[model samples]
Target: MVELQSGYKLKKLRSDRGGEYTSAEFLQFCEEIGLERQLTVAYSPQQNGVAERKNRTIVEMSKTMMKEKKLPYKFWGEAVNTAVYIRDRCPTKALEKVSPFEAFSGRKSGVKHLKVFGSICFCHVPNQLRSKLEDAAVKCIFVGYGKCEKGYRVYNLQTNKITTSRSVIFDENSLWDRDTQTVDSVTVQIRSEDTSRSSEEEHEETMIDIPSPPQVLAHAKCAAHIADTELYG
Candidate 1:
């Protein structure tokens, strides 16, 4: 798209010997564009110092974000994007106090829409489509701002899908944890009932009827006396 839009035929393209850049289609495209493709030596990343530095910076920042937010490893992509997004707008000594966004676009970047990464967010469900039993809003974990798409990247626990949303309600305070309400309550109640039932059963067993030794002896003596009297008569 850039080649087509530029209208000026590309002259030289310098990059690492990556599969995408070295593919036959890319080679053909470069040939068609009258472009020179220059690839750096394999394993000699020092030759590509700028790209290598940026990659290192992104990796370090991404790790920092994940560690800080306590997010899952699968969210590395979102962390990388957030790291790049913030770095792109941060002022540096080389840029003379001007941010990368300002330097590139010649305009100041807006910080109004910025949010904490991994914050809890609630997205409203359309009322017309929502069922009576369904919640009015769906809970989500904020990942980062979308690049190509015009929305924020969010992770939905219920759906297990990382999707984009234009509108959302954010809760920077909350963190994700497993819900144990019903199960825990039910287990406690069941244990209590079991304990009560066990105590009652124990009390009933302790009160079981048993004939006294004195009563049994007295009944046997009376029978023997009656038999003796009948034999003598």
Candidate 2:
């Protein structure tokens, strides 16, 4: 896709001697395409420093995003995808003043619609999917962007499914607590009296304005710093 968009013909392929890359079918395909294959020495990642560094950067960014949003590790794939999506729009030393997206597609990338990854969101439920008396939106977790569609990828908490929708409302300030009984599969039974008491307690806790510890605050600051520097540098 990149080569096609950039109107460039790929000449050489450099990669580690992974099984998938070393397969006979892959080698035949490359040979047919008249492309040279360059394989690094076994167990030597330094030979592929650029790719390794990029992978590490993506992983680190994904981890930071998941941690900041208090999202579960199960959403790591979504985080990684979102990180890559953001990275393509960010300026890089290799690309000089232009971003990877612009360099490849010949057009500047826009970030106006980007939202906080893993933030608590509400996706509008289509009228055909719900009755008039039912809620108009479903609670979800903002995951990433739709690759083939102009929409946001969200994790439906009620249905335990990932869905894409153009209509989504995000609450960037609030994160879903994973420890709470939010998943539909895990049902918690409570007595009528205990439910009322717990509701009151939850309200009181919500009203309390507790300050985050210095360590957490520092971590968040550091994450933001890294994001700005590595992504936009």
Candidate 3:
């Protein structure tokens, strides 16, 4: 509205048949402001060439970013936001070295806070929920910015959900190794089983064997009879 008021007297406003711009409230406001409302036909988005082209450009950029980073499909929103953010500040042929941000804001925008998308971030865990034995933070994937809050959208590893968190430490140089300890665990289990079986076999061989009770009684009686014979003689 400010841009419209600044540029012209707001004689007419044109848009597609989207629910956002074609609501009754918007029509009433336009009527009150002496502005003519022009809406394109239903299912005819091509009539709005500039908007459609911009949308296509942003979509392509987002796809390129996702492909380059090998990011998951669920992170499309983040990738798109990052693409738009970068595109806005980047110099374009039409702008002649002037960025969209500088053109809109009349000043250069700072790019210091930008970080690589899908990077590892450790978000601080709240003290109330963390146990003494647990770590002080949780690892997460940096997705994008928060739409409603003043923070970044981070996918929490523990919760398996996206959340806005301001407290995060980015590990840009780190990448997750999928099978770092896979072979070591299997080797350790095999060695432990082999050791256990060897010990069991050794114990079985060291067991002592004993004679039956009837053999012992016969030997004792024979010794007693010999003593009696000697005494009689």
In model 3, what lDDT does residue 46 have?
A: 81
lDDT of 3 by residue, 119-218 (tens): 6666766658764445656667777777678788888766789998887766543333334511111011111234556554543333223322223334
- The residue-by-residue lDDT of candidate 2 on 1-233, one tens digit each, is 75776688899999999999999999999999899999999999999999999999999999999998878899999999999999999998888878988887788978999998987777767758765455666778899999999999999887899989998766665567778844222123343344556554543322333233233334444554565478768
Candidate number that wins on TM-score, 2 or 3? 2
What is the TM-score of each predicted model, taking all chains together?
0.66, 0.76, 0.58
Enumerate residue pairs that collide in model 3: none
Decoy 3 TM-score against native: 0.58
Better of 1 and 2 by lDDT: 2
Runs off by more than 4 Å, candidate 3 = 1-11, 23-25, 40-46, 69-72, 126-132, 147-150, 173-233
Per-residue lDDT of 63 in model 1: 93
RMSD of each: 27.2, 15.7, 26.8
Clashes of 1: 0
In model 2, the runs with Cα more than 4 Å from the true position are 182-233
Candidate no. 1 TM-score: 0.66
Candidate 3 differs from the real structure by a C-alpha RMSD in angstroms, to one decimal, of 26.8
Global local distance difference test of model 3: 0.67
Off by over 4 Å in 1: 1-10, 178-233
